[model samples]
Target: MKQLQKLKILDLQDNRIQGLIPNDLCHLQNLGSLALSENELFGQILTCLRNFTFLREIFLDSNKLTSIIPTNLFNLEDILYLNLSSNYLSDYLPPHIGRLKAVIQIDLSVNNFSSNIPSEVGGLQTLADLSLAHNRLQGPVPESFGNLISLQSLDLSYNNLSGVIPKCQKRERTPPQTELLPTLAHGRIAYQELLRATDGFSDSNLLGTRSFGSVYRGTFTDGTILAIKRLDIMTDLACALDYLHHGYSTPLVHCDLKPSNVLLDEDMVAHLCDFGIAKFLGEGESIAHPNTLATLGYIAPESPQERINMREALAALKKIRHQFTQAVKGEKHEDCIALRGESVGSSSEP
Candidate 1:
């Protein structure tokens, strides 16, 4: 590793590399990225990571790393993307988590992190995607998180977090240069392919219609099924309103959320599919019809009167899920009782 001093990008993903991450690799003073994901690497994250002063990215996900995070590792000043997901890493994050000044993406999901999220995490002013899902974290979403004005996609689901969400502090509003679809770098189908799958946008393939346009069920040559919502806003222009509204660097207002605007994938995962009237939270006023608003049924009523944070959203969804489960159970019980009654009557028939 020492001989590779000029190596800036080291990718060992999907390899069988086991054992501790090489401490000597830090000798590469100019190293900018390191990806050791999907490996069997184990042991503690060492303090030596701080020595890599110019390191900007690291992918240590899907490993067997354990123990509390070393606070010294957070001292890496130039690190940007840090993915420690799908590991057995335990303990609470240190307060310096907020000090990741240049870091943008932090994924600590599927770990055993316990205790409150440090309020200073709001200090990650440059953070875009912050995921702490499936941890053992408890307590409220930090009020300081409102200071993460540039935050976009956040995943704190499956934790024990409570309390009302702190209204995020508004920061400079910079629209993403790239739209949302481009963010799905994987499994992307071209416009021509979409057309071919939907038989030139024929009505036969139309699954539904929405405020923006129609949705067609498309099946590619690989037999992958996808629901495509044709929107009026961008066969020409483009944006990532679905990603933008849900977790774009800031909370965005999806002004036209409705049944028609929602697409269900083969997995039945509901995706926000329309963005003709979306607004970034920090963005002031409407440029279009001032009163143009969200669909009456689906749109969350104006804030204050009706507002919810991420935690609240999770709770609400859980409640709905519980209700559905209960209803299904009730139906199954009735069916069982009815079948038993029929069986007894037939047995007793003369």
Candidate 2:
């Protein structure tokens, strides 16, 4: 390894290298990149990384390395990327992990690290992508995280995090380039106006209920209409809502879509009102065959060999609804359920 001192790039990934990463590998002082991921390496990471002063990127994921991250690892001020995901690394990340000022991407996901993300992580003003998914981490995300103005992708999913999500804060900005028309009063409104408009979410404003919580509609003092769905904490509704808004790489599956669980805006535009049973697609996550449909009135008389997509089911139901001369609202409306339970009704929730 001493003969490779002049090498700037090393690709040892997927090599099934066994035992500890040799300390002498750090002798390559000119090395700017290293890839040792997807190997069976075990034992403590060598403490000699501080000598690789020019190293800008490192990939050590998918290894069996143990022990806390060494304090000297962050001495690489020129480092711009780090991937330590999918390892047996344990213990809380040092608060100084954020001291790697040049790191623009970090993947600490799929590890045993527990505890809250340190607030100092917010000081990484250049961070664009940060993934802490699939860990034992608990506690609310640090409020300082919102200070990452350059952040475009953030993943704290599959953790034990709790508490309401922090709302975006106000910052100084120039006046809008375009003037507001008489019809357009203001550019934006505050959430407090929404809470007050719902009369503190009195039941009279309630529009629907789901496994998570209830949905309400309210008109602000400014005549701004909004729908607020207050979900229960124990139901993990906050994470579910966040996933629906930002985590999915594809359109999500809301298998239990129903009128009572959906809220309509003033223009009749609909936003998903309940996330109690939401599932992200394109990630190998599947819809619960019976539980999902049962809540939406698709309880099958027999086990299905293949799952039916919601679009196909809705199309078939529309045909049935069009054929009904009496115009049954749906198979699960109180009156319709009574009739169906008596074996005299047809069609299900659309």
C-alpha TM-scores of all predictions:
0.49, 0.48
| Model 2: ten consecutive residues of lowest lDDT | 294-303
Give the RMSD in angstroms, all C-alphas superposed, for model 1: 22.6
Off by over 4 Å in 1: 172-350
Error of 2 at 10 (Å): 1.0
* Residue 169 Cα positional deviation in candidate 1, in Å, after optimal superposition: 2.5
Report per-prediction Cα RMSD to one decimal.
22.6, 20.5
Q: Tens digits of per-residue lDDT for model 2 on 1-350?
A: 88988776787999879999888887887776788999999988777888877677789999998887787998776567889998888888778877876578899888888988888888776677889889888998888887776576788889999875554343445466433222334654455665687887775565444433456666765554555766434223222232232222442445455557654334332334554464334444443333332243322111133435656543333333222312232533333122123343322221
Model 2 segments more than 4 A misplaced: 167-350
- Per lDDT, the best of the predicted structures is 1
Q: For each candidate, how many residue pairs have backbone atoms clashing (under 3 Å)?
A: 8, 0
Error of 2 at 62 (Å): 1.0
